[model samples]
Target chain A: MSQVKTLALVTGGSRGFGVAICEQLAKKVENIDFSLYARSQQGLESTEKLIKQIKPSANVNLFVADFGDIASLQSVWSQSLKKVNFSEYQRVWLFNNHGSLGPITNVSEYVFNSFLIFIDMDQDHLSNFKEIESEITLNVTSVFVTSSLFLKEIKSVSTPIETSVINTSSLAAIQPFDTWGIYCVGKAAREMLLSVITAECKDTPNIKTLNWSPGAMGTDMNKEILVKTKDEGSKQFWEDMIKNNKLVDPNFSAGKMIDLLISNTYTSAAHIDVADA
Target chain B: MSQVKTLALVTGGSRGFGVAICEQLAKKVENIDFSLYARSQQGLESTEKLIKQIKPSANVNLFVADFGDIASLQSVWSQSLKKVNFSEYQRVWLFNNHGSLGPITNVSEYVFNSFLIFIDMDQDHLSNFKEIESEITLNVTSVFVTSSLFLKEIKSVSTPIETSVINTSSLAAIQPFDTWGIYCVGKAAREMLLSVITAECKDTPNIKTLNWSPGAMGTDMNKEILVKTKDEGSKQFWEDMIKNNKLVDPNFSAGKMIDLLISNTYTSAAHIDVADA
Candidate 1:
């Protein structure tokens, strides 16, 4: 009989921290299975290729879905389940890593005659209602829905498997970021959701939930912050971090995260700042 | 010719803190036009009657609408604008007072074999997916949509009016409430939204925003907490407050809110705890 595998479900696993995480896991664990979900097929394929190159015998499946849309997420989730039966897995690790930075414009620059011109700007453009909604959907609502669905599926399994949800969070989750209004709100909501879930699942021995902030990383997100931000102060800060090599490497952060997960040292619903760890 | 009236748009103004706010504003300000929105027409009528009893000449208009429904909110907002043109008022005070106390059970009692059973419970019951969504809609989404619409209206006005959004917040915004997961998340989002808006409107002297925590109040919400909660600790805490008369009176809190609004002493985007005020 084939040995049952430990399944890992990762959202936004196409590139950046997601790809780094998959790479680190492939190096550390043998005979592990991966189901990576992302919006870009090309990115997903690239990530899969890299993982396969690292571990020749690894089984890597890619699912295309936009976290911003509920129907798409639901469809992708169901398809993923069909590909990998929950009962066959000894353990399940869910990594919620997908998020968007949305429009990064200075609040001060948007002022016209003491009024925020962007507030009434066209929705088709950046920093409008559409962008704000998209940010919230991708960052907050998607995490909430995906985690809830995963928990439900775990509950339905005939043979219970050890499961844990690691939510990708940021300093923005606790601190208010200027010009990143919707994003900050979304991150804060994400942390609160994880905290609440942790509290709710206190007695469930097989389930664990944690919010993990990977700190500032030299990823596409950081690049976007450096390139897209109109705020001089914010731009300078990012530029300085990049120049001084202050940003954390995605591989290092991923390694730390995997170490924490495998050790199961944090049994409670606590936030783990990877930088501190 | 009648002097133009300063208009106040209050959501969830049928009862509780909403009614008290309307009552106090009527008592303090003369020629203040009030537009109260709530789901219960009967409750709105009763509130209007109370306002008139305090200030017989108060122009109190009741608009029946559910804040949770977007269509209903939009229709009511437009109807309110038609009733009193935005140009007619020198100032507008938007009191976002609507919220729901979602699933007030204690986290301590929910442990099952060292895990929470409610995490996988049916959605039809209490503290499920449906209830969580409802709480978010009423508390967070409603505030976002209403404030956005209000800002849009202010932008369109040919004659600018000094407008401010006073979001009725709670300690729950800063502190996590175990069983009130959705409610706590919603409140936190509300505060972040207010902070973002404040940053956006830093240059706009005509627009101001604040998240005001009215402290513990003896209202219908308090009654609900006392009656709906199954957690012994939470029950005892609230009961003790009631027994010791520690809860602030709704009218007194409302009076302080009106004082702050008129004085406009708080210009920054900071949370106002009534007890501190």
Candidate 2:
């Protein structure tokens, strides 16, 4: 008889914390299969390679999908399902981690950019409406659709498996972050989405949803905040954190996240900060 | 010179609370102009007629715009701005009242529907990806874009005027309503958008944003909730409220909302429930 394996699907499983999560799960969990989705093929391939190096017997699948594009996301979801026989898994987990910081600037600069970009700003600029829409789509709407798809896939399995959705949230979801307008709203929406899903799935014993804030991690996202932020105060704060070595290590944060997920320490619709994890 | 008028722009201003708001404002506030946007021409025309009937000399303009469509919204916004010079208004108010109740069903039925619709559901059904996208765009993104546009318009004026955005919100923004997944997320997103805007505009003394929760009102939205909801508990609750005549009158709620807007009693990003108003 074949052994039942655990299935873990993660979005944004290319670089930064995503790669750390894949590596941590590969090292910690035995007989687990991974399905990773990201926009960059190179990044996904490298992460898959790292996971294979960690667990030589682990089965890793990489899918290229842009969360900002619904069509691309749907295509990847369908393809991933075809590659994995979900019914053979003893447990299923979906980690929603893909996000974008959008435009970061001071309130004055944002207001100025709104007008500047309104008249002549390039469409590709971060300040444009299209970019804002893409950020919101990638950060919030994509999670909503992808998580819904994951739930549907879980329901399709003949045998009930332990299932959980760990939504990668941020402190910005609760607190106001100046100049990260779209990102803040998107994270807040994600938290609310998990809340609604958690409430709706209360009767369904097999499924659980949680919002997990990974805390201040030393990832590419943080690097972008430090380098690309236009707000002097915000830039200084991030710089100070980096200089003081205060940012959480990606590997450590990933391990804590996996621990919470495996232990099922949080099943309710609440935000779980890494410190609490 | 003609007296400077107070201009109010309302989305979904054709029926229910929107119409009530326009009527109440027309009757109560003198030297005020109205710009109403809605997809239904008949509704907008009738609303304009009612407003004109109430105030014979009032200037009421009706614009056809579907909140779900960005192009339509931009066209209407431009047309409205062209019609009314911003400098002519002593105060500019935007009522983000347009919204949609995405889907209403019990968890079991929703799961069943998900499976039923999973294979054959048009990608555009409320349960499908497209519908969810549209609902979010209409309920959340439209408000973001419109409010941004309002800010831009306000900036174009030579003289500064008191500007406020009163976002019509719901209890679902904070609470989880089973089967109303997208609606709940959208409302929450709206609240967060208001929050970000409120924070960003803190130093800008001219602009203020408020999320107004128009409690249980006997409007079409409430009737739909009572009739279409598949959640037994929620349906029962609404039915009890109706049976007990507990739903607030639309006119009364509108009056309270307008009073809050004019008085600027609530300047913060907090959710202002109608009962508190």
Candidate 3:
């Protein structure tokens, strides 16, 4: 019977589903130290307060990070790691929960009208590639870099520790959306990255991975999707969900995720939606 | 038909499947003008020779450019388009055929021992992110940029031209391969990009797109896969493939792909493999 101390590293903990995930983890994981990273200090503090109120004794450290800025991202991640003693914990959880959909716009200079192949693009088309590159760096590159770093750094610890890597995936990972083109690509790519990790670590039962898709949620993200989406049917579908109040709560979705990790019932490296779970 | 002159632009036209595809297009398409881009002038020239030997009157222009260098890519694409009068042709084909398997190694610092999660990364680990980013830029970013630019620039011609954006995809696009981590992600992402395009132009049958997977071809890529792959079972499978001479010929595969294009029966934006086609 070894003593168990868990290290829950959560990105995007400042707000939305990230905050909910932090709060859920706070209530569930006993004797846990949270390394919460996000871009906003104020938001991180608020999440910290919520976490502390739930588990007063939980030790939480916040790191302000901009995933789009790789230089700052590297500095932030390294700085966060300086204080951590990996051997002090028997369990490590890496939650790749941070992502962005960029601008909910058309694929490029094309404004996307069916049957109309050519339309005059605006001056904004000049900077389209820049936006596309930045969005990709944030959504796709950061996930790969962070997960690789986490596995590398954490595994360096001499002692054997159970590890779980949870990817905050979406139905978008498997399905394509019209205006959400880049978002869908990023999500789909991230899903495959997890699948590769799953295949590579198949024999290692302790190193469990799951792509957890939190269903359409009542979050700022959903609000953005509803507002900026270009596809009428897609927009109407989401608007209906909002009007019907049918969206999943962030906390409820986070609970399912944490429960899946705790219950250890999910097939490692498989995508399990909150609805299914 | 008043006039239908086809312009076929193939990347990776230096050798292997690119050459085969160019050859097939030269043989099949009447009054075809070929604009071929690749890193090797010799190889593109070879492909051009093959095309000219088949269709003696085929007008071929070769651009030697590196997809890895975005500056050079822009220059190359723009240069290739400089001499072209858009209205001269009724069909424009942009073949996103160039991609890299990168180093057929593990994802990152992790060597992937299944049970052993961490191993000391070499000094090469310092450059790992650089490689990852570059591979991504070449495979995923370039595909998006090129396709966007092609659709945008070519559509401005005002005259109705039948355009086909053919993405050189693979089974890797749908299945995750152990050592081919970035390749798999890039392919998968490209597949979705076409899907988004498909959805965007559902009513525009003139704007055809296909994710043409050429199958397990006997090309330089296959040789590299055989040599560098880290997984024993995967390597064994490929080795058996080589031993049994089960690899698809590049020309045969290319013929299948072009035939699918000529037959025009594949669902828009669907992945159509050579064997399946």
Candidate 4:
């Protein structure tokens, strides 16, 4: 009797909600294999260590990559996925859970008549656009391409296999948050990417796609929000959420998403938030 | 009494809908000074010629630069706007009307298992990603930054100039077009960018943003759809629309948008489609 094998890959698997996803999947899926991707080697190793502590014989591979560099993302991802013995696995999942909260500022803060000091903004504030560009690359371009490649890699596996692609989404995708313009645009674009994929992949029902809004989680991103966010209203809103201990734990949020997957209760391309489930 | 000198800038102003917008604005805006931007110098000159024919003495200046090049966009936009005597104008407008329809193919067509010949797609087809990337920059990034810079340039105008920034939007921004994933993403992102700006710019009553979905129009892009589009369903959809003459004329659609601006009937940051009016 032959048993089916399972494989999972998680982007941004080095920290926060990504780490939560890695841990939860390891505990829930029987004899699961993982390929983790992140920018930091140390964070990837540490996440691997935590996984190993749970299951000593677990197969976990770490890929370190900066999402901003297109060449690096394409090369590292292609090489790692090329090595997968896809025929041996009956189930595969790609968790596109990695992304950053791009500059938390009003869209207009990027504007101004510098010489006229139109809004008490810096004359050369457009320089701040570099970070915005890098953030866009990580959140939009890389995510779209990564998911595209995931579909590409799975198409070649002759063996009958089920594939699920999940994107970590946010409330900001649907609701406009003050000063969260770039972040909002990125989430909305990512969600639409999955929606388009679902529409295009009906001819291939074996392939699944989802946009899971993880909700407000206690992560490094939240910590950063507390310090450097420029929008006082958004900043205060987060502060109150933190002060009231209203933030969802990363593990809890991740577990809910995994349950949705396990139960197969989600419609493909649905943007189901944690609050919904 | 100092007379109010009205100024208008139209991006993608070389041809099609862009040309329509220039002609309509010059006809309607009461001796409006024109600044036109497009990648083609010849196209810009033609647009200028059309504007000059409409209003023999119209102040038409042409700036030619590729939207995909950041340095060129910055330098050209800045130098052109700097030459403007903002104080002399009581009204300013920017028509962010340029974009492209990128890769009208199913999202899965981008996928494949090369070794197994999983999908009968080209092995190196991801190279098509270059077009998608360029299209996104033209549609989303350039639009966002251009609107931002417009806000910046007008901001320094010490005079109380009533400013309007309009993004030429599409039904695709709110609806999914099968096989038009990249184009849909760009429209959605652009629309949301304006929404966030509207939300953020509440304090600056002088600045207003509008997204006008022009509906389907006879254009070079539509012509391309009949020839190169890979999705039969989408291609047929456009083909039928063309054959039936159900498509909106560029002049008519652009004229309606100009009416919205002239009437000041739209809520700032509101997405108003031609059908609605």
Candidate 5:
């Protein structure tokens, strides 16, 4: 009997939510292979150590890459996949959980009036629209490009029943946030993009796409956004106005991420809002 | 007699559709002054020539600057408006109609990806997304940031009526096109960005946003994508169809753009599809 091929690749896996995803998938899933991508080798090692602590024999590989770099992203599928035998995997799941929050200043302060700042922004953001552009490219564009690039390798594999994608979007995907303009726009686009991908792969039964809006979590992003606030300010502010009561523990969020992938409950082409679910 | 401010300020007035819009407005309205923006000094002179040809005493002034360069864009606005005397202008209309088109190829083929190219793509051509990402940037990031930048400026103006923004989008804004994925995705984001802008500015009635999709036209971008012969091609044979009366002239399309703006029939927060109109 052919060994089942079950592989999972998570971007931005070095720290925070991504690292948690690595640990959860390894501990919860059976006979799984994993590939996690991040910008630094040191960070990848930390995630690898955590995964190994959970599952001694977990087939977890680390890929060092900047998700924003086109060449690096292309390599994630081409050079990185060559190291693993995809044919042995019965299912392939990719989790794009990486992002960068751009500058907090009002964009108009510099963009339209400063030639220098505008050029610097375009160069620094990697051709992405300011806050929203970078967020979308990192969160959404990478998933689309990486999946399309490796369709050939994926199709060649016979054992995998189907390939599944779980995109980590935000509640902001549907509702626009005040300072989180780009973040909201990018997530919204991701929802539609998942719809587009599902439509493209409609004929292929083995492929599934999901737009998962992970409600607020105790992640580094939130910690940073809500810094300098006491329990009263933090708790009351989010609970009262921000409506951040749905904040889940990182491990719990990771478990939920894995559950969505493992469960056959995901109808193809569905926009799964974690809050709604 | 107080000189009335023209209802719209069109960027890239030297050639293409910008000049056409000025001509249309000049003929359609009375007592409306025009403020045109372009990068080239020669082009600005030519625009003045054309305006004078239509109406010898027409109130038209050229604001020279490169929009792609944000600082220049600012200088143009500040200097151009200085000459206008804001008290005379009641309503401000901004048409962001300038962009550059890049090559269409696989993402791997180009040294630098052109995700900004969506601002310049013709709607009919479908694109390999990875390639398009490499070539396009403006749509993913520039369009929204720039739009917001303009909105920020117009909001401060004491113009009693309202400021309306007409964003130039493509049919690809609604659906995907070949060799135009990056562009399509960018434009789609542009539409939503405007939606966000409108929603964000709901309290401020003076600011209005519209996303208009102009159908395929005989513009330079379209001409390049047209198939020399539509007959037997395995894939990418839309040009042949154009030769067989499948394509439409862009001038007629511009008429639709003008009509949308002038008719005021379309509301501020609407995403209007010209082909459907």
Candidate 6:
């Protein structure tokens, strides 16, 4: 591998794990250059300030974009690359850590009512159907757009060494939740996409595409899902499930991810589940 | 398992494979009824006409609504269910086959050769980083929103047997092509969704879900992709491979699907790779 400093791009870097990913990349990778993508301009600026505070000489830049919109990703990614002098960097580490969780109440009510009625199912309704469609778009389609754009870049770059594409998938990618059909489906597709990348870019040894399930983290997305459902009884239940069995702190997860980036042991362009990692 | 006629709701049943699914159901199962969904009034009429022509006494009702639109699905599904007299039907089979294939192009061309390059990677055009975002709403977001709503119905339904959701995913769902990122990502997420269903509903056997890859049929979508990509330089490769390997026709493939559905032998709510099937 070349000895050029690694360049890192962290999406959803405005808060939570994204911030952690940015910080860790700056500290771990020597001569690191960073581009942080997030929706909020203020968040982006704040993140940049923090990066600069940590390493005044770090070539840190902020790009505001919404993963929900394909255009934002297209613009943000393209603009970010425009500033890079790739010759200076030996390896590139792309960390896609942004995602949203929502539409949580559609199932708990069904489960509760079914428990009461002793009926296995609820009467059919259409409103919930539409919500699922929206969620799939926000969760899945956006990932495709972003990944597709990024992968294209990885393939085209004239770099001599290796480049890694790390997608932020979820354990939920393999497992489903009660009302999280939309989210689950999106993540599942992402896993398949990693497989596809594995097959398509089999010859592209210089590029390692992977969907990394950072496991569950105590992020806003986790809290958001809880708030959407408004379930007091199951709050502790979910928290316990995460704390006891599922959730991993963002910093710990980010550190592990940085290790994976440096380890370079994953030879196939397939998704690496964190539980297994 | 119930002797009562099976009730199937075929979204986008006006024509194409959706109509084919309806016809196949009528011929294969006795006393089967279909609630057909389509946005086009003429398409619905055509489906009804075809159903009447095929089986003079087949009980087929038309529900007019855009499956791509969330609110439309809600209104159409609810109103249509009310009219159907739910007591009459025993088990529900939701064949979600309605969808569209969006633009095919690399991220650069789609976004005007912008965002195609990342910072430090393409410093030549660093000053002109601002580029227009892709118009992804109509082609991608619409399907996601509607599917999300449909999933809600799947979660909420109270039928004796869990509703069967067979999403019409594509080979693209597993792989990314130059111009089909939007469609691929949307379907990819849905694939994960079924996994989610499998994990969450392990105890609940009523709902049978499959992220089906209906092998590359000579459908309109395939034709469009082939035409757009000039056969993607792999048509001959696939055709030659299939001919040499004696690949089965789509009709035969559909037969295997019907067999799987009726026999219920393949019970795991796992992703049944159509290629494998």
Highest lDDT against the true fold, candidate:
4
Q: Between the candidate structures 3 and 6, which one is better when assessed by DockQ?
A: 3
**Pairs clashing within candidate 2:** none
Clashing pairs in 1: A114-B204, A203-B114, A203-B115, A204-B114, A204-B115
Q: Which candidate is the best by TM-score?
A: 4
Candidate 6, residues A42-89, lDDT tens digits: the string is: 998888888887777788778888776554565666667777766576
Which candidate gets the maximum DockQ versus the true structure?
Answer: 4
Give the residue spans of candidate 6 off by over 4 A.
Answer: A1-3, A106-137, A151-161, A225-234, A241-247, B1-3, B39-41, B101-162, B170-184, B198-204, B230-233, B238-251, B273-277
lDDT of 4 by residue, A95-196 (tens): 998888766666655643455455654333445344566667788878766777777667767755788889999988877776778888988888888888
Q: Tell me which of candidates 2 and 3 scores higher on lDDT.
A: 3
Model 6: per-residue Cα lDDT at residue B260: 69
Candidate 5 per-residue lDDT, tens place, B87-153, comes to 5666667776665444342222222224534653533233444544433343455455456556656
TM-score of each: 0.78, 0.91, 0.89, 0.92, 0.77, 0.79
lDDT by residue (B1-277, candidate 1, tens digit) is 1364678888889989999899898987777888899999999999989888888877888888887665566557666756777887887898989988866643222212213445645322333333344455667766766776677677678876878888999887887766777677888888887777777776677888878899889999999888777668888999999999999998899899888887878865678889888
Ranking by TM-score: 4, 2, 3, 6, 1, 5
| Number of clashing pairs per prediction, in order | 5, 0, 0, 2, 33, 46
lDDT of 2: 0.78
lDDT of 2 by residue, A1-277 (tens): 1364788898999988888889889987888989999999999999988988988898888889999887667667766876777888888888898888877753223333445677745332443344455666788778766777777677777888888888888888988876777778889899888788777787676788878888999998888777667657778888899899999998998898888777776767779888888
Candidate 3 residue A147 Cα shift, in angstroms, is 1.2
lDDT of 2 by residue, B1-277 (tens): 1364788898999888898889988977777888999999999999999988988887888888988876567557766777877877888888899998876743223323445677845332343455566667788777766777677678677788888888888898989877777788888888887788778876777888878888889889888777677557778899999999999888988888888876776767878888888
Task: Give the DockQ-based CAPRI class for model 6.
Answer: acceptable
List lDDT for all candidates, in order.
0.76, 0.78, 0.79, 0.80, 0.63, 0.63
Interface RMSD of each: 5.3, 3.1, 2.5, 2.1, 5.1, 6.0
Indicate the residue-level lDDT of A265 in model 4: 67
Q: Work out the iRMS of candidate 6.
A: 6.0
lDDT of 3 by residue, B63-145 (tens): 99788766567656765776788788888888999999866655545223333433533312334355566777788877776
Alpha-carbon error at A10 in model 4, in Å?
Answer: 0.6
